[model samples]
Target: MPLHSLNHFKSVFIYDIFIQPADQNYLTARFLRVIGMHQDFFWHAQQTLEKLFKAGLVLNGVSVKSKSHELTKLLPIYEETLGSDAFNSFDKPKKLKAELWSDTSVKDFVTKISALGSADARYGLVGYQSSKDDLFKLDQLVFKLRQRTMGLDWVIGEDFRAEENLQHFNGKTYREFIEQNPTEQIRHLSIPYQELKSIGENTQDLFHAWNFEFQRKSSDIDKIAPGAIAPELAFSLSRIDALLQNIEAFDGFDKEFVPEGFKWLLDNVKVSSHWKKMIETYLSESKK
Candidate 1:
């Protein structure tokens, strides 16, 4: 089978496995056990073979048996593409620079970003100060363009003091600390609870029709509660707000100070409705 045919299920399974870590070798065994093959070694083997074929791995023109080696091979590609370490070490910085420079005429970059098969793949730096530099670059580009147009002293002021405070607040660089521990990074990236709640309330109003089920009945108490908002929905919206705030702060100086790269970043900021729906479904199902 062509790799493209396997795209949908492969991505879904890989994401579940990555976010909810399980022993790869034991996956076949656990699956077999669930299907009532715990005591039947032969049945276990057969089922494993079937799974391997379904997963698109073949050997000698036959579906390969699920062995440790074959399973390990699938592991690295996913880790490289979807893992936090992979994003922090390789993809994020490159993406940040690319998006900043892409500006308005960055369709290719947008398409590439859209191809990323992860929920958290939209912006390079979510809540960190490193992202500010890209914003600064955009501001400079916008300022320069305005200067050329108006022929005036239109210089954007640099926020060096704020940048320095972010840099030296702790003993180490923010990226270094974030890379060292992702959970901590998430905590550091999080907005205040009140702010997140306010956003949820605001989004609930903007998407009022979408909240119909939650508002329909007084007996549907659980549905109307603040916790009823899907966790991923809340998180994603908060992230978007954070990115917007960063953009606004950077653009506060003047429209002319907008970085040439801001267009690229905006172009690549799309998150598909299908993916968002999937996240919402996952949250609802998990809550149940």
Candidate 2:
């Protein structure tokens, strides 16, 4: 049998080309927000949500303007194209307040970030205003879009195995049923909160180290290579006493920046064999 297929448009992610950039932006946005970099946060938040909306549009077979930044325009277009399947929001005026994830508030957010078509509102060039709430509501909208737009089909990789049984019915193959009814396989995508927290702390350290130069603090803005971050776990366990216990319990990988195994560093990582042996011997002394 061929691979199992879910033809529906559901909100899930595995290797979404759209999501990779969005993830980077998401990480950056949260970092900026934590560091009191509110202006840049607005811009990155707008970028993140805009990409998500575009992802929804593209996933649903809807055409998107490649160079549009107007969330007001993009959000509406994405909804209208998806139609009833779009999960569009309507306004509620007489309520006590617009709830956190309400349709009214989401649209309100899209409006606030919509000054993209005609001018660089991100820099306040067009005399428009934005607030921190823009990000809060945008986060809500991101969640909504994930559930409505992502389908389980995304998780199906090239190495995915097909089902043994093909249940054909209703004048349609199994793929047809799944494609039409995406909610059957609904899911959502997310990132680790702890990682975002670390990025913020590291960014602050880098900022202070370089005298708070927002621009050109390093060669690449996205790929920040800060020397140190807070809450160093390797040292957090009072290792002077627990050193031997921690060694045996080690994860067999360096957790400083991100997880990487000693084996890979031994083979593919660039370094002289002499240095590698020196470090290996140094670590071996811990066993004594």
Candidate 3:
């Protein structure tokens, strides 16, 4: 019900729901570029990251300028609000972890992604193209930010389900709080419970699509050679397999809701031989 809680919720939802999916779409486009799909990656990524950066600023109580897309410029605002120590504590993407943390590297990373927001990248104002490395860094940076914002509502003692004051934190109470606040930002944060529910449901849908649809449809897959597919897709499949393994061990969500392929993937993961076998089968079948 508090402002911090609202900010945390907005930041997390924007990053996890909107931004994360856009990032995955960007990644998927890299391997499955057909027409304007690559542009989808660039534009959506720039827009999402810009909003995410602004949300981060709002979360930290830093003033956000209206409609800014230059994420590198926001770094100073973050530093001023949260302090350099807090910013430094952030765990960057794993690939960049070994490198010594520097303001320059951070700025460079942000700037490169921000450049995608330029008219050239968005509308082909001039000759411009995004590289694979650029896309990869954008993916990693967004992932880290998404993870950072994930449990913030709980941290701020604003989780409606966990907080003792259920009546005060309920929808009616939150609506009343927004009315009292009378800020454009507060007014805009009127998130329906169903909308929140749909975010989780949509993620479940993605899992189902990947497991049942993408993996099930033999023609949907592209075989690079006799027994190998694109490395990006294989890595993604392995990651999904690992995700299912973790879920099975952790037992957080309803196992009944998990698709059959997720279970099968985990079983295959245990066998270790199944990955190679499946690829071989795919290749042989494709030949046929």
Best by the TM-score measure: 2
Q: Which segments of candidate 1 are over 4 A away from where they belong? A: 1-84, 87-173, 180-182, 186-261, 266-288
Question: What is the per-residue lDDT of model 3 for residues 1-288, given as tens digits with 9 covering 90 to 100?
Answer: 221333333443344434455445444444333333566566656665665555555544444534255766766665565443223333344566444333335566667656756667768664446553554555556544433332222332343232443345354433343334322122122221222322223443433332434463433233222222123344323433343345446333333423433333233223246754653454454446
Candidate 2's displacement at residue 129, Å, is 3.7
2 or 3, greater by lDDT: 2
In model 1, residue pairs whose N, Cα or C atoms come closer than 3 Å (at least 3 residues apart or on different chains), thus clashing, are: 100-261, 102-264, 103-263, 103-264, 138-258, 138-259, 139-257, 139-259, 142-256, 143-256
Better candidate by TM-score, 2 or 3: 2
lDDT of 2 at 41: 71
Clashing pairs in 2: 7-179, 8-179, 10-149, 10-150, 10-151, 11-150, 11-151, 12-150
User: How accurate locally is residue 169 in candidate 1, as Cα lDDT from 0 to 100?
Assistant: 36
Which of candidates 1 and 3 is the stronger one according to TM-score? 3
Stretches off by above 4 angstroms in model 2 are: 1-15, 65-67, 87-105, 116-119, 123-132, 151-206, 209-288
Range of the 10 consecutive residues with the lowest summed lDDT in candidate 2: 1-10
Q: Write the per-residue lDDT of candidate 2 for residues 62-85, one digit (tens) a residue.
A: 544343667877877876765655
